[model samples]
Target: MRLVSVDIDGIERPGAVVTGPDGVDRVLELRQFTGAGSLALLLADDVALDLTRTAIGRADHASLPRLADVRLAPPVRPQVILCLGYNYRGHVEGHHEGHVDGETGQDALPYPNVFVKTPNTIGGPHDRVVMPIAATDVDYEGEIAVVIGRTAQAVDESDAMSYVAGYTLFNDVSDRGWQDRSSQWALGKSVDGFGPLGPWIVTTDELPDLGGLQMEVEREGVVTVRASTDSMVYGVAFLVHYLSQIITLQPGDIISTGTPARSVQAQSAHLPLADGETVTIRVTGLGELTTTFVR
Candidate 1:
């Protein structure tokens, strides 16, 4: 099921299950039904509610308000936003220019190039992305993010999928100049409002074939990036297994499986977003996330 976090009137709230052909979002008040913070909480249930059954059985949807009337927030309150770099072959070749062959004329790193984005960097779907004047080379990297459901350490690839609660869209906004200035990507990637996530989180059962999903990013209505999850050098299960070996992944932790081929950096010019510019990213079953740039 598609779950969302929303702010009704002035109070912040969570829980929305996708319903209908009109694209109308149905509200599932977590406090009343589940007493939880995120979709991860719901997934922890031994007998998870089926999306169709839940939607049909909800008495609140008829008595309460529609989701479009409320302000939205990021679907999950992620503790850490882990990101992967060069996970897709085309993205590495395109963004690195001719350097896709590697700096030493060798090959790219055999394993996933991992980095972290602070939780503060995350914003909701309709939120404005604050563009820092300190950097003029900001660009967008659209990716599919996995939300962890269970606490895990040294998880195996075979069991990795069990730890996932759901998936969401992520925009790994970066300051190209700051990123290249240091070997660490923290300064460039962890900027405030740099990570825009969610319209909602789709439960893992809702999307059994995530590997076949398409991801696309558009700037001002023009598509700049387009590729499928099939292009990923290391898939989600492998990432979860690899990450758990080094760090404990808790419920609410987010792992954004890297972007596809096509970011402004790939074009070789600083495509810094101007104030009022909008970027929209969509993943095949996960829905869309839109953020406007503001100074």
Candidate 2:
């Protein structure tokens, strides 16, 4: 079931998207539809409920309110946002001038390249990504964010997937200049409202083959990034296990699995976003997340 957080009559509420009795798409307020109080509870369940049988019950899609009318928020308010860098071979190679050589060319990174963006940076679909005055080159990196369902510490690689609640889309907004100036990536990545995620969260059980999904980013209706999850240098399960060894992975914690090639940086040599431009990022199963840049 796809769970969404929506604003109804000025109050933010949890909702589930289900087809009603008339085979129409409708958003059911969780309180009215199911005993589940929040999306987090639905995610924590091990058994997937047949949405049609329980909440949806075949209603007319036209009967539901238009999704655009509601104010969107991140599907879940995460305690922390763990992000991975250079997790895609193409992204690593592209940043180094299209050369993938390990010995003498651009692909010579010594580590896995990890970083963290604070939870305050998180926003939701239709949120605005503020282009800081300090940044001259703000770029968008579209990535698949993994949401952890249970607390995990020192988890084995084989058991990593068990801790995952589901997946969502993330726009890893970056200030390229700040990133290059500082030895640490936190300054460049942690800008408030830089990370925009979620229209909804899709449970892991609903999507069994995570590796086959595709991700893409579009700027002002033009596609800039396009690639599949198959290109990830390190998979989700491995990263969870890797991070669990060092830090505790708690429920509502988010780990962005990294972006694919063809992002803003890869397409343009040195172009940064201009004020009033829109960036849209989409993942196969997950929904689209759009952010408008403003000075």
Candidate 3:
């Protein structure tokens, strides 16, 4: 099921997407039945997940609402949005952005470089991100984010995937100026509306081949970032298990895996987003997310 939350009468209601017989995609809203209007609430229940599967499997797609006409909200309003900074080899180590680096060099850091984004930063897939008054050099990082479905603490790497509910696209927007100002990443990473997430969540069952997932990011007709999860310095399960060692992960928590290196075009001619410009990120099975920038 393409787990999602749809807008109905200006309100967000949790839903699952089903393909109609005529080949059109439609929504199967779950809010009324589960009493869970948010993905955070809907995903916390095993019964809700099961009910969604049962209902969607038997749904009459022809009678369902078309997904195209519905407005989308951030799939989950996570209480804790944790992110990784340099988990992809191409992102650092002085190589071309997408080129894989050897185990030596900056990639040698065994520990994951993790950071936090304030809850205020999370915005909807189609939300217009307001330009911050204090900074002008804002850039974007396209990432694959995993949503936690179960509470986990001190979880092992072998059991980490079990805790993940689904996958979603995330834009880790940043202010370069502020980021260079300090060694710490919080100020640059925590700007309000810096994190744009979700068109919907693609539950793990939909795509069990996690390692081969490909990711791409485009800005102003140029491919700025392109790479696969196979190139990640730290894979999904390890990152989850790594984080669980420190803090308890609750259902609806988000952990954004780091962005790949910028494409050659980006490395040579990249520029901060201008007002009205848009960035679109697409991953193999998780779907695409397009974000517009506004002043």
- The TM-scores of all predictions, comma-separated, are 0.88, 0.85, 0.93
- Model 1, 131-193: lDDT tens digits are 877976777878888988788799999999998878998998987778767566688888888
| Ten contiguous residues minimizing lDDT sum, candidate 2 | 97-106
Name every residue pair that clashes in candidate 1: none
- For residues 169-190, write the lDDT of model 3, one tens digit per residue: 9999988777667566678788
lDDT score, residue 282, model 1?
A: 88
User: Tens digits of per-residue lDDT for model 2 on 212-290?
Assistant: 7878788888888888888777788888898999999887789998777786564665378889999888888887888
Evaluated against the true structure, the overall lDDT of model 1 is 0.75
- The best candidate by TM-score is 3
Best-matching candidate per lDDT: 3
Candidate 3 lDDT for residue 50: 86
Which should have the higher TM-score, number 1 or number 3? 3
- Over 4 Å off in model 3, which ranges? 93-105
